[model samples]
Target: MYRYDNYDQTLVDERVTQFRDQMTRYLDGRLGEEEFRPLRLQNGLYIQKYAPMLRIAIPYGMLSSDQLRRLASIARRYDRGYGHFSTRQNLQLNWPAIETVPDILGELAEVQMHAIQTSGNCIRNTTSDQFAGIAADEVEDPRPWCELIRQWSTLHPEFAFLPRKFKIAVTGASSDRAAIQVHDIGLRLWRDDEGEVRVRVLAGGGLGRTPMIGDVVRDDLPWKHLLTYLEACVRVYNQFGRRDNKFKARIKILVKALGIEEFRRRVDAEWEHLKDGPQTLTPAAVEAAKTHFPEPERRPVSDEAIAAYEQQRQEDRALARFVTNNVTDHKVAGYKAVTLSLKRRELAPGDVTSDQMEAVADLAERFSFGEVRVTHEQNLVLSDVPVDQMVALWQALDELGMANPTVGTLNDIICCPGGDFCGLANAVSIPIAQALQERFEDLDFLYDLGPLDLNISGCMNACGHHHVGHIGILGVDKKGEEYYQVSLGGNSTDDASLGKILGPSFYREDVPDVIDKVLKVYVESRHADERFLDTYRRIGIKPFKERVYA
Candidate 1:
C-alpha cells in the first residue's frame, strides 16, 4: 500500500483545520446552510435521513492492515459500532456526530487517508480491480496510475464543481471486475505485441436515469500520456458538459448528444494544450509509485500441506464449498485468492462491524501479507492467502462471521441503503435485498443459475449499480405506493451494456415472484453451461419478458 509523504500529510492537516473552523462557524450562525452545504460535502459529511453520514475513501480499494485497524478505531470512537462499505470502494459511517466530523478527519489524516472527493459533484474515488497486483492475467499493476489520478483529482481547481458527480475506474487485467465500462472514464492497461504499456480509454459511460455503455475515445494511448489525456478529457467536459439540467449533466449524456466521433474530436483538440504539461507522467514517477507494490515472497512449503488441502476438499463438504466458492486461481502456484464475505445471512450487504473489522485486520496479518482490498462489488479480498493456510483462514473468518462463501451468487446482493437510511431514496432497498436472499436460500440452486448479479437501488441515482446487474431492480414510487422495476441482460465486463427494462414495474411484494418467473424462463431456455447473461443475450429479453409478465 502507498504511504503518505510530508506533502500529503500537510495538505490533509490543513484541510482538517479548515473544515473544523467551517463547522464552528456554521454552528455559530455565521455560515448559512446554503454556504455550508458545499463545505460539508467536500469534507464527506452528508445530512442523511436520521443523522449525518461521513464517507471515507479507500483509494483503488486497497488497504493496509494498519489502515484497517485505524478504520475500526474510527468506527468505535466516532460513530456506531459498524460502517457500511459502498459499491464505489468507499466506506460510510451512518451515525457520525456532525460536530465531531472534523475530529474524525483529523484522525483519518494520521493514517494517510481522508474523506475528500467521496461525495458531491466532483471527481469521486478512482476504483480498480480489487485483485490488481495479484491477478493472473494482469499486464501491469493498475494502482500506481490510480494513485496518480487520486492526487491529481483531489481538490482539482478546474473540476472542483461539475454538473454532477464523475467516476473513473481502471484495471490492468483482461477481466473487468472494476466495472470500468460504466464509469465516466475507464482505463484498461494492456501491453501490445511490442511489449509496450498502453491504456484503452473509454468515455461517456455511466448509469443513472440515463444509462449508457461508454464509447472508446482513445485506443492504446502511450502509458506516459495517461494523466495528460485524462486531464484533457475532463477539461473538455468542464467546458461543455451540461450544467442547466442535473439529469443530463454526466459526460455520458454529452457523449451521446454529440456522437462519439465529435466527442473524440473535441477531446483531441483539448489534449493539444495539456499533452506536455506538468501533469504528464514521467518514467521516474511511474517507477517510484510502482516501488511500493510488489509480489510477496514465496515460502518453502511441504507437500504434506498440499495433500492435506486436497484431502480436506475431498472429505469435507462445508470446507469444499468454501474453497470452491471463495477462492480464485492465483499466478503463483500453491497460492490462492481469498474473498472475505461481507454479506452474512440476515445482514445488510457490504456492512462490517468494528470488531469484525479488527478481526479482518488480524487475519490479514496472519494469513496474507498484511494487505486487504475492497472489491467493486462491495466485498473484501485477502489477495495472497496461501493454499496450505486456507483452512485455518476459513476457520478464523467463520468465527468473525466473515465466512459466507456466496461470492458471485444470488445471496451476494449489491444494494444501497434505501428509504430507511438515505433521504434521497424513494423506497426501501435493503429489505427487498433481504427478501430476495430469503427466497433464494438454496445455494445449489443459485450455483445452477450461474453467475447472476442482482443489483438494487432505492432510486434512479443508480448508487447500487442496478443498471449493470444481470438482474437489475430499481425502486419506484407511484402515487405513494412503493414499486420495483426490473431490467435484464446488463453486464459490466469488457462487453458491458446497460440492462433493458422487462415491462411494467411490480409492487415490492411481487418482485421476487417476478424474478422467479424470469429465472424459470432462463432455466428452461438455457443451453448446457451457459451463464445467465449469456443466455439472456443469446435468446434476447423477449422470452424472459414474456414469461415474467405472462
Candidate 2:
C-alpha cells in the first residue's frame, strides 16, 4: 500500500475542510439542490432512495489492516453496522445522513482514503486485478501504473468533468482477472519475445445500455508513453464525445459512431502533440510509483510444511472443498491467495458487517502480511497467505461466516443493491439473488454445474456487471411493474462478449423457475466436462431461450 506523503495529506485535508463547509451551507439553505448537486457528487455522496449513499475510494482495491479497522469503526459509528463493497473496488455506505457525509469523509481521510471523483462525470477509481502483485502467471505488476493514473487524474483540470463517468482497468497476467476488456480504457502489460515491456491499449469498451468489447487501438505501445497515450485518448473523447444526451455520452458510443479506424486515427493525431510531453513517465518516476508497495519476504521452508498442508487437505473434506473453490496458486513457492466469500445466504451479495470487517482484518494480520484486497467480484482476499497456515486461516474465516466454498459457482452471485437502496433501480436485486441462493442450496450440485457466472443489476447501468455474466439478469419496468430480463452466454475475460437477451421479460417471481429450466437444458445438453459458458456458446442461445420462455 502507498503511504500518503505531505502533499497527498495536505490535499485531502483541504478537500475535507472544503466539503464540510459546502455541506454546512447546503444544510443551512445557502446552497440549493441544483447548486449543491455537483459538489456532493464530486465528493462521492449520492442522495439515494433511502438515504445518502457515500462511496469511499479504495484505489486498486488495496487496503491495509489499519485501513480496514478504520472502515469498521466508521461503519459501526456512522450509519449501519455494515458496508457494501462495489464492483469498482470501492466501499459504499448505504444509509448515511446527508449532513454527516462530510464527517465520514474526514474519517476516511485520516486513513489516507477519500471519496473524490468516485461519482459524477469524471474519471473514477483506477482498478486492477485483485491478485496483481502475487499472481503466479503475472509478467508485471499493474499497481504502480494504477497509482500513476490515480495521481495524474485526481483533480486533473483537463478531465475533471468528462462527457460521462469513465472507468479504466489494468491487468498484468496471462488470465484477465481485471475484466479489462469491458472498461473505457483497458491496459494489458505484457513482455514480448525480446523481453521488452509492451502495453496493449484497448479503448471504447463499456457496458450499461450500449455494451461493447473495446477495440485495440495500439498493440505495441511502450510503457514509458502510457500516461501520454492515455491523455491523448481521453482528450479525443473529451473533444468529441456526446454531451447532449446522457445515454450516449460514454466513450463506447462515440467509438461505435466513429468506427474503430477513425477513432484510432483521431487518437493518433492527438498523441502527436502529447506523446513526448511532460506527462511521459520517466523510469525514475515509474520506479518511485512502485517503491511504496510492500513486498513480502521470501523464505525457504522445509518439506514438513508442504506435508502438513497435504495431510490437512486429506483429513477434512470441507477444508478440501474450500481449498478447491477459494484458494489460488501464488508466485512464491510457499504462499497462496485466498478469497473470502461474501456471497452467503444470510447477507446481501457484497455486504460485510463491521464485526466481519474487523475479523477479516485480524485474519489478514495473522495469515497474510497485514494487507487485504477488495475484489471486483465483491469479495475480500488475503493475497500472501503462507501455505502451511492455510488450514488455520480457513478455520478462522469459517467462523467469521466468510469461508463458504462458493467461488466460481452460480451461487456466488455478483449483484447490485437494486431498488432496495438505489434510486435509479427499477426493481429489487437482493431478493432475486436470495431466491437463487435458496433454490440452489446443494453445494455439490453447484460445483458439478461448474464455474457459472450469474449476475444481476437493478438497471442498465450494469453496476453488477450483468452484461458479462454467463447468465445475466436485468430488472426492467413495464407500466410500473417490475419485470426481469435474461441474457445468456455473456463472458468477461480476455475473450469478452456481451450477453444476448432472451425473448421477453418475466415477472420477478418467475425468474428462479426460468433459470432452473435454463440450467436443466445446460446440464442435459452439455458435453462431458463442458462448462456452462462453453455449452451455451456451442449450442447458441436458441435452446436456453426456448427452455426459459417455455
Write the residue-wise lDDT of candidate 2 on 1-550 in tens digits: 7999999999999999999999999989999999999999999999999899999999999999999999999999998889999999999999888888888889999999999999999999999999999999999999998999999999888898799999999999999999999999999999989987899999999999899999999998999999999999999999999999999999999999999999999999999999889999898999999998868775665588978888888899999999999999988887889999999978999999999999999888888889999999999999998888888899898899899999989998999999999999999999999999999979899998999999999999989899999999999999999999999989999789999998899999999999999999999999999999999889999988777766
Q: Go through the candidates in order and give each one's C-alpha lDDT.
A: 0.90, 0.93
Q: Which stretches of candidate 2 lie over 4 Å from their true place?
A: none
Residue pairs in clash, model 1: none
lDDT of 1 by residue, 1-550 (tens): 8888899999999999999999999999999999999999987999999999999999999898989999999999998888999998899999998999999999999888999989888999999998888888888889998988898899999888988888999999978888888899999999989998999999999988899988999998999899889998998898888899999899999999999999999999989998888878899999988877766786855778878888999999888888888888887777888998888655788899999899899999998889999987888999988888988999998888778878888788999989988998889999899889889978889888877899999999999999999999999999988899999988888788789999999999998899899999999999999999989989999998878777
- On the 0 to 100 scale, the lDDT of residue 60 in model 1 is 93
Identify the candidate with maximal TM-score.
Answer: 2
Where's the lowest-lDDT run of ten residues in candidate 2?
294-303
List candidate 1 stretches off by more than 4 Å: 302-304
Overlapping backbone residue pairs in candidate 2 total 0
